[model samples]
Target: MTRRVYFDHSATTPVHPEVVEEMCRFLKDNFGNPTSLHYFGQKARKAVEEAREKVAAAIGANPAEIVFTSGGTEADNMAIHGVAYTNRNRGNHIITSAVEHHAVLNTVKALGKQGFTVTILPVDQYGMVSVEDVAAAITDKTILITIMHANNEVGTIMPIAEIGRLARERGILFHTDAVQSFGKIPVNVDELNVDLLTISGHKIYGPKGIGALYIRKGTRWRQTLFHGGAQERLRRAGTENTPGIIGLGKAAELAMANMEQEAAYLTRLRDRLIREVTEKISHVRLTGHPTKRLPNHASFCFEFIEGESMLLSLDLQGIAASSGSACTSGSLEPSHVLLAMGIPHEVAHGSIRITLGRDNTEEDIDYFLEVMPPIVERLRAMSPLDQETEFALSDRCNGCRVSHTCRV
Candidate 1:
């Protein structure tokens, strides 16, 4: 049987063995609710708190500042909506980027319908948001600025620290959806100067149902999504997910211990894949900032074919990749992030994201390099746009007077 290769870490990752062990222990032996106040409950409570501390340490925040949620989407929604509603008296305006995740986009749109004006700052060709544009968007009515730290589709690392500084100077709250960047790169709340940050455990090799939000100390925000419990400092109300939280804690700890080493390794593998792919494949272009992007993310768009077809082909070859976010996969719409980066709709439809992870190796990259080009060639051959490309190349060669004269 042929071994399968996974290159879609940006979408999700397999749970680490250590994390699974910890989670299983909790699930099998310690099944007490954290809210019960008994011995078993105390055990569960302690595990949850310790997990909180681990997650906080990963992002350079205090344990108390961390609020565990369902996942990154919920965390982003909580951060954006919480700040918006709590500070409604202060302002009715919010600022975000044109390339935000749909989680943020839909929430912002909902707020827009409720009369809150949202200013979406456009990115340059590299999918980077400008600090100057963000500064300009701020007004007396500006309540919050929510921008993703690293774009999920294109992997562009925004200038979040600069934006945070500007937001601080204007007394506006700033939040970053660090779901893609959190485990892959280092994030410090104070250094970034952000009031709120969102993270997901599944992106870090933990359980999928658990995530956390970082609310800076003294940051004022009201809970937008409320349930019945005293959990998460009353900010997020739900019974604690002990097994998931334990797994998340172990994942965070492992990430902190190995981030630098893993980053360097993944960088090498990702760059090798990119170089080989771009060199061997024609009619393909890289997306996102060349240097200032995630170490593990390599995104590109091959002209003509739909991303779905490319993804299906890759899967048939036992290579797992993604067109865009898992949430928007079924939609026919082009990725907003690629579109925001000025990539044409036709090219955007052919976009593919290949994200490396700690478990991947040079052997895996070699297998992908061996298999990917032919697959792409086959897809391109089936594309109607290939005929147009051939025509254009022929026309260019025919129009070259120097070539014609030399031939004569």
Candidate 2:
């Protein structure tokens, strides 16, 4: 049997054993509605508050500021739409990057249909958003600026602190979807100076269907996304996902304790993957920032082949990987992130994203290196794109803007 390896940690991670263990007690023993005033209810409520504190401490936030939601999408919507409606009288404009996850892009697009003006800032060839563009996009009517902390598809970390400072100076509320960066890197709400931030549980080795939005205590925001009994301090309305919340809290605790050490380990493996894959494969280009990217993320585009084909071939070899954001993978179109970074449509169609996690080892990377080169070569041979001649003449490399550094 082929050894199965998972290299799609950016899409989601397996729930940690400790997180599962921490949540089991809530499902069986403390199964009571947190809103009820009974003894069991009080016990559940206490557990919920404790979990809030754990998540808060992980991101330098106060417990009152943590509003639990179903997942990152809902948290993102709540932050953007909540602020849009709450502060409509103050402004009707939003500023965000062109490379944001669909969650932010779609939410802001929906707002645009409702009479709000939006400024979608462009990114450099390396997928880094320009802080100057952000500053220039802001206007007196710009009420919010929502950019991702680290891009899901390419793993480029944004200059969020600088952008946040600009937003602060301009008196604009700032929000960031930290789903990809929360556990993988250090994210302090104070240091980023963000007015609101979103985090998903599954991205951090916790249960799915659980996430949180951190709204600075004095930030002008309202909970208009849902209307129901006053749960989440009247911010999000639904019976709390008690078990998932417990799991998320446990995951956050574990991340806070081991993040630094784990980052170093993942970075080494990630760089090794990058070096081996680029050196072994021909007509390949690394996407995203070469260095200012996530420690665990390695992305590339191989010419003369499509991403879906490479993904399918890798799967048969018992490796789970991705062509782009899992949320957008169903689409046949090329990645918006790669396109935004000025990669041609043909090149962007061949992109692959390999994100590492705590469970990965050097042996796993070695296994991948052993299998990946042949796969790309096989695909290139079968392709009608005429790799040898076309690849030499096409100037696609020079057009990609990374040709000077790309090993190919």
For each predicted model, how many residue pairs clash, with residues at least 3 apart or on different chains? Answer: 0, 0
Q: lDDT per residue, candidate 2, 30-101, as tens digits?
A: 999999999999999999999999999999999999999999999999999999999999989999999999
lDDT for each residue of candidate 1 in 284-388, tens digit (9 for 90 to 100): 677888789999999888776778988898788898999988889989999988878766677688889999989898999999888878888887778776433
Q: In terms of lDDT, which candidate is strongest? A: 2
- The per-residue C-alpha lDDT of model 2 at residue 293 equals 91
Cα lDDT of candidate 2 equals: 0.91
The residue ranges of model 2 lying beyond 4 angstroms of the native Cα positions read 388-408
- Steric clash pairs (candidate 2): none
Lowest summed lDDT across 10 adjacent residues in model 1 is found at 399-408
Pairs of residues clashing in candidate 1? none
Estimated TM-score per prediction? 0.94, 0.96
- Report the Cα lDDT for residue 201, model 1: 93
Provide the RMSD of all predictions against the true structure, rounded to 1 decimal. Answer: 4.6, 2.2
